[model samples]
Target chain A: MNTIQIRNITKAYNGVTALDHVSFSFEFGKIYGFLGRNGAGKSTLINIIANRIFADSGEILIDDLPATENMAIHEKIFCMSEADLYDTGLKIKDHFKWIHRFYENFDLEKALKISEQFHLNTNLKFKALSKGYQSIFKLTVALSLHVPYIIFDEPVLGLDANHRELFYSLLLKEYENEERTFIIATHLIEEVANIIEEVILIDKGKLLLQGNVAALLETGYCVSGMAKDVEDYCSDKNVIDSDELGGLKIAYILGEKSAIPQGSNLQVSAMNLQKLFVKLTEKGGI
Target chain B: MNTIQIRNITKAYNGVTALDHVSFSFEFGKIYGFLGRNGAGKSTLINIIANRIFADSGEILIDDLPATENMAIHEKIFCMSEADLYDTGLKIKDHFKWIHRFYENFDLEKALKISEQFHLNTNLKFKALSKGYQSIFKLTVALSLHVPYIIFDEPVLGLDANHRELFYSLLLKEYENEERTFIIATHLIEEVANIIEEVILIDKGKLLLQGNVAALLETGYCVSGMAKDVEDYCSDKNVIDSDELGGLKIAYILGEKSAIPQGSNLQVSAMNLQKLFVKLTEKGGI
Candidate 1:
C-alpha cells in the first residue's frame, strides 16, 4: 500500500521554486533510494512530508488521510536530516530521555545497545562530543525511534568506513525484523545501492524515474576501450558521460549491451549506480 | 627527483603518539593519494611537511633542503587544510589579493575565470559564504597557487558533484601544464581513483601499502554468484568483505583470478578503490 502520497506539491523560496509540482508515492515494506544532485529538492520534499514546512500548493496524504498538522500521522513518521538537532547544553542521556517520550515506538533497549557498541558517553553534554560522535547520537535516536516511516538524509556523512558498515548492517537487520518503510536520501549511491530495493531519481525539482534497483542496472552499460573506438560505438546511443585516461576511455551509456556495435574492441559491463548518477548529472558534452 | 622526503618522522600530542616512525618520499610530477581513516595522522603528517608543525623526532627535507621553519622551503609548498586561513570578515576579492601577494605563482586570471564559473560572489565576505562556497574559495587559491608541491586534505568535504568534477578537471589541466606534484588526502577514494597515479594506504598509524593505482585494481577482485558457491570459493581465499541479498552473495577477495577453483559459478571483476579500502580496513569477518 502507499504509505505516503503527494500530489502536485509545490514549494518556493522568494523567486526560486525549490520544488515544482513534484508528485510521488512511497510504498510500505520497501527501502527506497531518494537520489538527486545537491539542492535538487530532496530535503524540501522530506520537510513537506514530515510536516515541518507547508507546501505552497497541492496536497499530501499519509495512510489515505490528509497530513495537515495531524499529530497521529506525524507520530508515525520520523525525519532525520543531515543537520544536528540536539540541544547543545543538554546531556546526551537527557536528550535520549526526551526522544523516548516523544516517540510511541521508541525502543530503549535498542538505543542502549547501540550506545554501548558506539562507546557513547551519556554524561557528556551534546556540544562536548565530536562531530562523529554527535552523528552517532543522532543515528542512535533515529534507529531506536522504530517509526513506521523513517527518513534518513545522509545519516552517515561524517562516519568512518567501519561505522558506515555497521550502520548499513544494523539498518538491514532492523528492516528484516520490522518490515518498516525507509527512504534514504544520500550522495553515497554505490554503498547503499545493494541495500535499497527501490530507486527514485529526481532532477531539477522533477521526478525523473522510479523503479526496482535491478531494472535500472539492466538499462545502462559501462563500456571501456580506446577513446576513438568507444566514441565510434557510442554514436547514435545515449552516451551519458565519458572518462578518459591516456588512450583508453570508459563511457557510461543509457542503453542495453545489444545497442553497442560489434568489433569496437570495447568491454561492456553493468553500470554502477554511482557512476550512472554522475554521468546523468554531468555538466556538458555527454 | 624527489620533491619531498621524510625520514623516520615521529610526532606526539600530549604524550600520545600521532605519527610513529613514518618514512616516505614524494617525487616531482605525480598525483599521489594519501589515504587513511580520520585521526590516522594525515593532518599531522601534512602539517609537518608544510613546516606548520614540528615532528617529535626524525627529519623532513623539501627540494634537498631541511624543512625547519625555513621560509625558502615553505614558499615552495602549499597545504590546504579544513581550517580557513583567510580573514573571515574580508571580501572574497580581498582574500584573493592577499593570496596573490603571498604566493609568487598565484594566477589571478585563472582564479577569476574559475570563480566566475563556480558562481562565487566576489563581494561577499568569507564568513558570510556557505560551507560549500568556503571550500570552493580555498580550492580556487590552491589551484591558482601553482606551487611545486600542493597538498589537499579532504578538499571537497562540503562540495557537491558538479563542483567536484570541476575541481578534478582543473587539477588535471594544471598538472598537464606544469607537471607539479599534487597530494590529496581524502576518504572519497572512488571519486578520485581515476585521477590518482599512486595510492598510499595507512592503517592504525602505520603504512599498509603504497603503489600504482592500476596495480592495486589488478589485485583486488569482487566475485558474485550463489550464496553457497560464493561462500565455498571464498573459504580458502582472503575474503576482504561480503554482501548478501536473498540467495545471491558477493565477496571482495584479494588475489588473482587464476587462484579460484572451477565449478563455483562465480563472476569475478575488479574491485573499486573505495570497496577495497573498506574491506582491507574492516576488523571482523564479512
Candidate 2:
C-alpha cells in the first residue's frame, strides 16, 4: 500500500516543544483533513514531511523510503504553504514557466486555464497581485502539478465567497478526475466537512483523534430539552460539551446513544463536525 | 439614530472602477455580514467608510456628521484590517499601552483579560508573533475597544478551529452585554450563516442583494429526483443551478414553493446560505 508514515516524530524550538512523539500514517488515494488548534504542531509536522525543516527525533518514510536528504522522495510530495516562496520580481506567467521546468509532470495548459477562470492577470509581477489573487496564483500552480500527494496549508486564505466556492468545486472536480491524494489543513471545518473522507486531530503536540469522518460523527449525539432534565440525564453520562439558552439546554454526548423514557421532552440529533471539534479540543469540555 | 450611511459612493483605481454608486446604511446595535468576490469592491467600500481611502464621489455620515477627514469621526469607528499597522519591534504589552494613549475610550483592562484567555504572551514583540497570534492580538484589541461601531476585515485569517470558536463565543457575549454595531467581512459564509442577522452581497463592484437572512433564505429551495424526471420537470422552471450524480439529479430554484403533482418522486429541501450564494454569483448561472 502507498502511504507516508511518520514514526515517533519530535521537534522543539528554544526549549519549547512544538511536536511531541507524533506518529501516524496517511494512506494514499484519500482526502484527509489535518486539524488542530493554533501552535498545535500541524505546521511543524507538515514542514518536516515536506523537507523544509527537520525534526529533532524520529523519521518519516515516503512509501517505505527515508524522506530526509532524499531528492527522489521530494518529488513525491508538493506542499503549498501560506508563505509565498516565489520570487516577487518575476511575472505571474514567468513563475509558471519556472515551475514547469522544476516539475517534469507539470500541466502548464491546465494552470493557464485556471488563471483565466480566476481572472488573474498573467503579465503582472508576483508582488503586484492583490493578496487574494496571490493565493489564487499559488493554488493554481499547486493543483496543476503532477504529484502523488499535494498538501494544502490554509488554501483559502484571503479568498472571497465566490472564489472560495469556485475553488471547492474545482477541487472536487480534480479529485474525481485524478487518483492523487489531498491533505488539507484549514480552520473552515464546516466547508470541508463534507469533502474530507478521513479526519485527524491534534492538540498540544499530541494526537487527539483519528478516524473516518462519518463514523466519528456518528458517535456524537446532542441531547436537548429543559435545563433541569438535560442536567439530570447527563449526570452520569459522558457529556463532552453543552450550551444554554435561558431555560433550554443542549448537552453533547459521545458513544452509542441510549433510548429516552417514553413521553419525554428530550430530543437527540447528530452533532456537526465543527461543534464536535470545538468540544473535543475545548479546555474544560474534554 | 446611530448609523453609518454611505450615499452614492464611487471609487476607481488606475481607470478601473471599484465601487459604482454603492449606497447602504449600517444601523447601530446589529451584526451584519458584508460579502463579495475578489476585486468586487468590498474592501474599497469599507476603506471609504473608515477614511483609509478616498471616494471619487458620494459621502459617508456617522450619526449625521460628515466622516471625511473629520478627526472626531475616527472616534466613532474602529477598523481592524488585514495589514499589520503596528510597529514590529514593540512588544504586545507596549502596543496596548500606545493604543490606550491614542483612544481615550480604549479598554486596557478588558484587553489584558482577553489576552489571558487566549494565552498570548504580551512580552513578545509584534515581529516575533506567529501569523495566527498576530491575528489573535488584532482581534483582542478590536473586541476590547469601546467604540460604537467595529469593523473586522477577515478577523480570523490564520486562527485555528478552537481559537475561532472562542472568538465567536466571546463576540456574542460582548454583544449581549453591550449596545454596539459590528460589521464583519469574511469569506467563511457557513460559519457565520446563523450569526449575522442581515446579508449584503456585492458582485462586479455593484450591490447584488441585501436583506434579512431568514427572509432571503425563505426564497431559496432545492428539488431533487431521478435525472431524466428532474430535467423534464425543471425544463422550463426558474432553476438557478442543477447537479447530477449518476442517475440522480438536484436542481436549485428560487422563490416560493409550488404544489407538486402526485407521485412525482421529487424531493424538496431548503437551500442553505452557502449553496445559494454559489448559485447566485456563479458565472452564467444567473
Candidate 3:
C-alpha cells in the first residue's frame, strides 16, 4: 500500500480529548489541503503523524508499516513545522549541509538552486533572517528532500504577495517533476484553493469532510434575493448561514442544490472554498 | 482640517534608510489599507505616527495640530499594534478596567459586549488565552475606544475564519455608528479590499501607489489567449507580468486598456487586488 493510513487515532492532553477516533488516509501522488480552525487539534494530529508525539490509542501506518517510534520510516516522511527548529548560530548553508548529511535523499544541488531562486542568502545565520526568510528556509529544506510524503504547516506564514506567488509556482513545478504526496496545512484557503486537488477538513477534533475539491464544492451553493423570497426558498433547504442587508439576503445552502423556481428574482452562485469551510465549521462542525 | 498630514517623513536605522522623504495624508472618515512587502518601512511609519518613534525629518499633523510629542493629541488617535503590549499577568477584564481608567474615550461596556460576542473569557489572564483569543482581546479594546483615528496592524494574525468575519462585521458596525478614520496595515489584501475605501502601497521605502480601491483596480486587467495572440496584443500595452502555460498565455496589463482587435480571440478580465499587488511589487516596485 502506498499511503499513510491513520486508523482510529485518539489523543488527550490534561484529560481533554484532542483527537477522537480519527481515521483518514493520504493516498500517494496527490496534493491535499488539511484545514481546520485554530485549536482544532490539527497540530496534535500532525505531531502524531510526524512521530513527535504518540497517540493515546490507535495507530499510524506509512505504506502498511507501523509508524510508532519506527526509525526505519523516518526517511519516508518529512514535516516542515511552523516553529523554527534550526540552530540560530549556524548559517543557512551549514544547516543545508547538515540536512544533506542526515537524510540520504536530501538533494544538495537542488537545495542550492532553490535557495538562489528565492534569493535566500545562504551565508546569513538562521537568527539573522527575517520571519519571511525563515519560512523560506524551512520550505527550502522540505522541497530538497526526496521524500514520498511531505507536509507543510503554515509554509508562508510571513511571506509577502510576491514571495508567496513565487513559492506556489515553484511548488507546482516541483510537483510536476515528480509524482509524490504533498499535504499542506494552512489557514490561507483562497490562495491554495486552486493548487490543492483534495481537501480534508477537521473541526472540534473530528473529521467533518474529506473529498476531491471539485466534488466537495459542487455539494453546496448560495442563493441571493429579496429577504422574503430567499427565506421561503431556504425553508426547505439545508441552509448553513445567511446575511441580511436591508431587504436583500443571501443564504448559504449545503446538500444537493435545487433549481430556482420560475418567475422568481433569485440568483444562484457557487460558494468558494473558504466560504464553504467557514460555513461548515461555523455550524459547530457538521 | 480633519486629516493626518505626513510631510517629508524620513527615517533610518544605523544609516540604512527605511523611509526616504515619504509624504502622504490620511483624511478622516475613511478606511485605508496600508500595504507593502517586508522591510518596506510600513512599521517604521506606523510607529512614528503612534508616537512610539521619532522621525529623522519632517512632521506629522493631526487635524493641523503638531503630533510630535504632543500629549494633548493622544486621545484623538489610537494604534492597535501587532505586538502584545499588555501585562500578561492581568485578567482580560482587569486590562479592560485599566484601559477605561487611562483613556477617557474608552467604553468598558462596549468592550465587555465585544468580548462576549467573540466568546472570550474575561476571567482568564492574558497569558492563558490562546493566540486567536489574544487577537480577539486586542481587537475588542480597539473597537470599544471612541477615538477619531484607529490603526490596526495585522489585526487578524491568528484568528479563524469565523472570528475574522465577526471582527470585520463589528468593525463596519463601529464605523457606521460614528464616522472615523481607520488605517489597516496588513498583507492580506483580498480580505480587506472591500472594507478599505482607499489603498496606500509602499515599496523600497517609497510611496508606490495611493488611490481609491475601485479606481485602482480599474487601472489594470488581465488578457488571456494563445501565446502568439497575447504577445502580439501586449506589444503596445503596459504589460506588468505574463504567464505562459503550454500554448496559452495570460498577460497582466496596466494603464488604460485599449479595445481588443476585432476577431482576435482574446478574453479580458479585471485583475484582483492580491494579483495586482503581487505583479506591481514583483516588478521591482514600479
Please compute the TM-score of chain B alone for each predicted structure, in the order given.
0.92, 0.89, 0.89
Candidate 1 vs 3: which has more DockQ: 3
Per-residue alpha-carbon lDDT of candidate 2 for residues B215-267, written as tens digits (9 for 90 to 100): 98888788888988788777767788777766999888887787765889887
- Each candidate's lDDT (Cα)? 0.82, 0.85, 0.88
* Ten-residue region with minimum lDDT total, candidate 1 chain B: B277-286
lDDT of 2 by residue, A110-195 (tens): 99999999998999999999878988998898789878888988888888777877787888888889888899888878778878
Q: Where does candidate 3 clash, by residue pair?
A: none
> Comparing candidate 1 with candidate 3, which one achieves the higher lDDT?
3
Candidate 2 stretches with Cα past 4 Å from truth are A222-237, A242-251, A259-269, A283-286, B222-252, B259-270, B283-286
Q: Sort by TM-score, best first: what order? A: 2, 3, 1
Taking every candidate in turn, the Cα RMSD to the unseen true structure, in Å, is 3.3, 3.3, 3.5
TM-score of each: 0.88, 0.91, 0.89
lDDT of 3 by residue, A1-286 (tens): 9999999999999999999999999999999999998888888898899988999999999999888756889899999987677899999999999999899999999999989988899999999997778999999998888999999988887777788888888888889999989999888887888799999998989988899998888888889989999999998998878877679998988888777889999978677788888887888655
Candidate 2 chain B, which ten residues in sequence have the lowest lDDT sum?
A: B277-286
List, residue by residue over B201-225, the lDDT tens digit for candidate 1.
7766667778899988988788888
Report, for all candidates in order, the number of backbone clashes.
Answer: 0, 0, 0
Q: How big is the positional error of residue B204 in model 1, measured in Å on the Cα after superposition?
A: 2.8
Query: Candidate 3: fnat, from 0 to 1?
Result: 0.54
lDDT of 2 at A147: 86
Which 10-residue window of candidate 3 chain B scores lowest in summed lDDT?
B277-286
